[model samples]
Target: MTEPPRTVQSYIDQTPAWPDGTPTDFIPMTAMQWRIWLLAPAGKFFEGLVVFMTGVALPLIVKDFGLSPAEKGIVSAAPLAGIMVGALALGGLADIYGRHRMFVIEMVVFALFLTGLTWSPTYLWLVVYLFGVGLALGCDYPTAHLVISESIASKDRGKLVLSAFAFQAIGALVRTVVGFLILANLPRSGRGAGYMPPRSCRPSCWSWAGSRSATAGIG
Candidate 1:
């Protein structure tokens, strides 16, 4: 069905006003604005990093946890469930509480949970940490745009937001390269050589083969 005509919110229609009472459209970026522009996309960047890094690490995770197929499925879906819950619950929290406030809170939560994930001692703990991380990321995912557009000059909004969004891709790319390097270079069990020879490498192969030895994991 076709939608009704759209209208911008009256508040949204009003341009941003900086603290120094500068006009919104044509001014240079302030230090705070630059900070926002640089940091806002961290949500996307971490989202991509977590998703791709999880896939890359799944084999080791499964092996370490002795997870069966069903359990593996649960492991894979836990973060997603947290994202769903965060989107439903935290989104409104931002609206009710405050966007910028929640944006900062979410990252603090994200960092806490991410650090917790590294030291997770059991499968259940791992799932919990992942869920927490997902929750923070989910809340911030939408907040990033609100924080950016409201803080930035209108002339630079499109360019800054798009570049910020690309952090997701950059994060994924960085993880893929890191994963591949570790796989092809590190010892399997402190015994023999690495998983695959460097000559056999391909940058594009990580999506499927990422969980195992980078080269071995690929088709």
Candidate 2:
């Protein structure tokens, strides 16, 4: 007697051919694609550098401006206050607009204002510059976080975010180097004496050999 016919489902279950021979397509990523991922952090590194310098130079800045310590505190507070307001305002905009576009705009605005800080002629001008810095600071933090979540793969998201933070470290390093260089070269006075030295000795050696010397005056 003939065996009963095998059903389609039975054939499917029995067949290893289709499973083994299935065709699929996945485009391999290029080196350029990988590099593109780093561009964001590179942008962030510059931002970090600016923020770092501002902090490192604060004491010297207070002296330069002849500000009372309390006034110095207020000047320092300005950026934080601006950042908070910026976060409230720009964060909302970033959420409403696309993060990428908003981030670009924020970065350009920040860079411009940060340059202004270098040339600000008065305390008011400096505060004005920092207001823009606050706005940029607010937008960048959330925007970078959002970009990492959206751009990287699920397993890699944590690493990308860490990479962005790593740039902050890099920025801090850059600012430290810059502050030291400036102090080594610039003139300053303290403790009832002027401290100006030749530009030959390194920061470590100079600090020890001291005459107050250009003590971290970048602000």
Candidate 3:
């Protein structure tokens, strides 16, 4: 007589070992792995936040700095340029040294440079600080990716990495909405109206978010 068809669970139960010769028992994500996974997305969020804030604050920056069109273009492109340099250079360093150390160091640098924006005395200074921010951010990309990929189980690796990138979109959206809300509430014509809003808000927001990314490295 023909035997009953085996169920999926029966097949799994019958399997003796993984390809690596380990037992085929189900393994769950560990606490440390989850922390690493969540931290990666926080880094991506700030990466997107800093990039979008440049555009959002551009008009105010132009007004404040009296930037020529050519100067404005350079200031806007500085972060992207720095990012390229950082990715090429620091990415290799992370691989050689270690991802966790690089991640913590880079996040601290990112926060420090972002905070420097609050006190920039000239357009050149602002550009320099922004470039530094980009450098740190560039280091973060590979380091964060490496940390998360190494920490998580193979089955969920791709999904978690993709989810981390999704936070970039979320960060962009938050910047837009916050900028709109701040603009809407300001008086149309007042002493400190347009001047303080973007200038004050951007640095504070950047510093706060950057610090959070830095602290996440400790977890």
Candidate 4:
């Protein structure tokens, strides 16, 4: 009888050794793997949070900073620029050193820079700190994926990696809900009362949002 046509997957399955000649072994899921999977997604969550929170905080930032259209544009684009730099620079470093080391280091840097957003003294400072946060976030993208993929078994790898990335959507949803709630509680005039000055409402809201966003990654 003629043999059936071999598919790509069949070829892969039939192969008993890696290209380097190491024996292929099935890796079992373990508690450590589960932790890495969850932690990797948390990085994506923070990335989404930082990206969306800027939109939520923009109007307030503009109002408080009295930013001209040009300045506003720079503020909005700063994080993206930082991401580009980090991806090009730090991503390569992760490849050379190791994924897990970069993963932990990047998250710590991300948390510190992200939390600093709340205390920015000026528009320039805010832009600088936001850029720093984005740099750390950019580093996370590759490192997190690499760590998760390497830690998990081949059979379940695709599902787990995609599942981890799903947290980005969750982060966006959370930012939207939180932004809505904060706006809902504010006065119709957009000014806060009590201890906070009418003009201080925007910064206060931004601070609260920044703190919450930082928490997601830090934990």
Best by TM-score: 4
- lDDT string, candidate 1, 1-219, tens digits: 997765453333456668998767745666988888777888887777776787777766675667899888887888778888888778777777788789878888887777667666688887898888789878887788887887876667788877887988987897798777666653344445434323233322222233232221111
Local distance difference test, each candidate: 0.70, 0.60, 0.72, 0.77
TM-score of each: 0.71, 0.68, 0.75, 0.80
lDDT of 1: 0.70
Over 1-219, each residue of candidate 4 has an lDDT whose tens digit, in order, gives: 999997654543443667998877754566887888878777778767788888887876786678999998888888888788888788877887788788789989988998888778798999998899889888777788878777766677789888887888888888898877766665555343322224645446777778887776677
Give the local distance difference test score of model 4: 0.77
Better of 1 and 3 by lDDT: 3
TM-score of 2: 0.68
For candidate 2, write residues 88-198 as lDDT tens digits.
Answer: 777768678887788778777766776566656577776777677766776676776776666554445567677787876887787788768766665654443544443
Ten-residue stretch with the least lDDT total in model 1? 210-219
Which stretches in model 1 have alpha-carbon errors above 4 Å?
Answer: 1-27, 189-219
Error of 2 at 161 (Å): 1.4
Which model is ahead, 1 or 2, in terms of lDDT? 1
Ranking by lDDT: 4, 3, 1, 2
lDDT of 3: 0.72
Please give the distance, in angstroms, between residue 106's alpha carbon in candidate 2 and its true position after superposition: 0.8
